[model samples]
Target: MPPSLPPRRKSNTGVIVTVTLVAVLAVVGALTTVLVVMDDKKSNSVADSGYNYESQAPTPTRTYDPGPSSEAITPTQPPSAASSTPRATTRTTTTSTPSGPRPVLKTKDNPLFLGENGTNVVTCNLPKWQSTPTAAQAFFTAALPCLEAAWQPVMQRANLPYQRPKLVFPSGKRWSSGCGDVTEGEAAAFYCPPDGAIYMPFEGLNVQANKNMIGSYLSVFAHEFGHHIQALSGAMKAAYQQAYEVGPDTAAGLEISRREELQAQCFSGMWFAAAWNGKGSITDTVVRDMLEDGYQRGDDNNPSAPRDHGKRQNYGAWQKQGYEKNRTYQCNTYLAPASSVS
Candidate 1:
């Protein structure tokens, strides 16, 4: 091929140099543009892959004691559910975003339901369970800090006060607190708002009546912690006052109690979801044991028992909802229908 020449000109040398410079500049600019586009795409790819729940660490398989109890022991009562008139009122929080201030959603109106999603708590290494008060006490003491850490962000986001409640492992079958005297049979474990302490009597756990799995116990503790969440968020006091005004033992009052209880169950499930396969000790098998125990914790089958907690199906249903969904707003039982909570 023959190279083409420019038209005859008086300053051909200068024109040739100018044309060569322009061509070189064009190549350099094109290369720069390609590099910039490639770099931008690389940055976007990294940003898009940010911390997904599904990308968490694999839960290590742990050996569980398969010895099943004759009957599952129900998580009987949250002391706050009892007939107590609370003077405190329901507290609401406001949310802000780029657009403008947003009022809480009607369905997830509770203050605790502010976060985008529930948190995966820090790695937790729980002590072995020997079915003794001392062992249980140690396990719970170690766990309280983790719970505090996990919920701290949510509370802060909601503009709610966050603090660790007192953890008390009562010794005897019958024990009394600022709330009232409670027997082992009445409440497996309870949260008392007066002293802001979680009461976990060894007898109340009924460790013998269930599989010896740590996650099962953790779920129970988390459920009671759910009550403390209610108390701190003013949900407990507000629900109590409403129930008291309508008579705590009446149908309406019981329905309110069921919503409170089931919501706690949902919260418990969220905790399990956060911890399972993401942190220490909580594995799929552990969650399985917990769910198996939880399925039987409902009050439906027992004729004599008060229907404060939902049916066994709904009982497990809400927990799985929290676990699978892993969102605080999704656990709102208050907005649920009478049939669903019932």
Candidate 2:
């Protein structure tokens, strides 16, 4: 060999540079992993539940029709009525607590969810229940003004459109309505959104089961009124559109129906709370009976019943929650988990 110019001096530069590059790469990779994890958590917080904390009305891309949705009652029949009308009365002013309660703007945004949890003590002096069809109509008619008294102010405060729902007492077992023709046994009562009418057929009320307990009938009527509230607040339209888009009989559609029905139950409880202990026949006994009736009206109570009205426990649970809380925010079924509604 020509003899190396000199023994090659050991150099740490290559080793040091290689180690530095490896360390830099490791740090960069760790940072990237951390960022990916944070982004995943942020994205899934609301998406997993399919809801958001936006306080805006639901936006529907197209018109939808919620056919004559029915609230079935106990299996029994009563007499028939040819006609009925809400008794006319002077408007009553409602007083609420100052600094109105704000709605819990969490899951679903609705106008009725916007107003104060009103504390207006209603004075509903109802007629005694009678088995005859005419007497039944008279009793229901008398209660109409009372219901209007209770809800008008609430609607006004919520900034929702308010109008007295039209009333009818069909005489036969089959009758036609704005929504469609309805068989007597199909439902005890139903609300027709197109015409804003509540069709209460005497034959469908199943009054024979609770002839003396007028509160039972009142609860039924109030549940229908709850649908009216949904209609006025745009909640009904939004829910119906979703169901229509996903096939009303599908699992998702049924879940949506449960939410609407359960909310109605809560609304009925609210009415009972407001009308309880008032200047009327609504006594402790009557309210208790109403609550019991709610407990019995769950889907699980009836075999062959569709699961659109929630299970037994949840059914009464929501009603009791509303009756005790007496706050609309407490009645937000849309915010509840799927398990709760199911």
Candidate 3:
């Protein structure tokens, strides 16, 4: 296939920007996330979980030790997951809420309900599958049009203004952009709201995941896009404020972070389902890989890691909850039982 003429640029003239910063909840490297103010005036750098962003470098100055207080992590429950069909599994309790205000979903009335048979399902027009950077870049190139068809209605339904986010897939062990450059393993893939773009370096999948399964890689892309959904919905701002109100690593703050991360998972599942059902290339095998990938990424899988994201069971459940159930309401971790969210 050949390239098409450039699409028109979207205007960000009067959209309000906030001082809050946030990112996908995980720890591969430094985990110091840089976020954008709601306004595009400038992007702000902040740690992924903690309030501030110290300088970033290829060499990690700080240990991944978020902190210590006997909230030692739970083990990663093995995923009995296979294909798109989900299985019921037991969940583990990991956090105890100290007496404080719990985080709430910012918008009670959102128009993001897309069920299995819902409207606006868009089939992806992906290029021939290959494990190379050029192939992956072309994959996203085709995927974005489908994304626009599937997600724009979600924003419009909520009566919020929407715009296409920027995209970049730099090739190297290190690169710098709207978000500061840290070295490899610090981040595999992440969304920076300030720059309004999704950053996907080649190593994100090729090295970090150590496997070249396209389905799993696409899930990462969709997850980051899910963050874009949050930024556009104002949910990111509310969650950031809530996290700041309570310390980011505290029990409350971690729960808020988990809910945020889990919601992103749910959103990823939602979009994937729509694309798959609408003649997308996600096969049953790809669905299995996606689950296995989610299982491995669970925070509880790593004992020394922070439980900023939920355990494997909950992580798998929330994703399945979105895919199997299809409704956004079912994906609301903020309003869920702490046990389910944990």
Off by over 4 Å in 1: 1-108
lDDT (10s digit) by residue, model 2, range 121-184:
5668888888778998998899888777766677665555677888888887665666666554
Q: For residues 207-260, what per-residue lDDT tens digits would candidate 1 score against the true structure? A: 554437675567667777776777777676667666667975699977777677
Q: Report the Cα lDDT for candidate 2.
A: 0.50
The residue pairs in collision within model 1 are none
- Candidate 3 per-residue C-alpha lDDT over 1-342 given as tens digits, one digit per residue, 9 for 90 to 100: 111111222212211111111111221222222211010111111112211222322111111222211211211221121322221122345455333222223532233322212214566767766778887788887887777776777565444557898888878866676546745445556677667777776655543333446656666676667777777665666776777789777999778776766676666666655665555576555555554444334554345555566654555455544554444555556666677656
Query: Cα lDDT of all candidates, in order?
Result: 0.50, 0.50, 0.50
Q: Per-candidate TM vs. native?
A: 0.68, 0.67, 0.67
- Count of backbone collisions within predicted model 2: 0
Worst 10 residues of 1 by lDDT: 21-30
- Looking at candidate 3, what is the lDDT of residue 244? 72
The TM-score of predicted model 3 comes to: 0.67
